[model samples]
Target: AKDNRIRFYTIGLGANQMQVDSILGPITVNAPDDLDEKILEKLANESGGMFFRAKSAKDLTRVYEKINQLEPVKIDQTYLQPKTPLYPWLLAAAFVLLLIIRVIQWR
Candidate 1:
């Protein structure tokens, strides 16, 4: 994920520090063990991000909130679609012209 301008907030489920370290960026490892301190200390040092160990549901919620805070999404623009039915009007006009033509032919 390079040169894409999109930052990643990876949540590694059941991954060890040795495995998470091999990856780049802010990665939260939700593993069985808490995680090695040496790895956690150096996690932000190299990638300029934080490493969180999600042990429970609350931890996972906090991690998601942190990620949202880091990368806040904003809508750039809004598009509106006009709601109009023109086909019925066109059909009505055609029927009126046909009726006029029939009256002229009868006269």
Candidate 2:
């Protein structure tokens, strides 16, 4: 979001509505686990996009092919780095603790 040279093209996300913008649900039926289909639908319509639901391998492939055919979005991905330098240390501590416990029990 911070990048000025980027456009977002989110697709097939279960959390979002797949209204007119999606390429999977509008034309076909999806599986039971298809989450937030209505939301995606609403989002697509609101965003002035198309929505599609791919229930099978062929449909899924078709969706991808369709997506590829669309115009390219001009945006660069923002590289996010973790602020916690202690993350690696925490992992090491956990491994050492487990090793010490196993060694003590082996005696």
Name the top lDDT candidate.
1
- Per-candidate TM-scores read 0.49, 0.36
What would the per-residue lDDT of candidate 2 be over residues 65-102, giving only the tens digit for each residue? 87677745577799888785788989999999999999
lDDT of all predictions:
0.65, 0.62
Model 2 — which ten-residue stretch has the worst lDDT? 1-10
Clashes of each: 0, 23
lDDT of 1 by residue, 1-107 (tens): 23444444445333343234544766555546654655664644455555665745677888899988987889869889899999999999999999999999999
RMSD of 2: 16.0
Top-TM-score candidate index: 1
Q: Between which residue pairs do clashes occur in model 1?
A: none
Of candidate 1, the 10-residue stretch with the lowest lDDT total is: 11-20
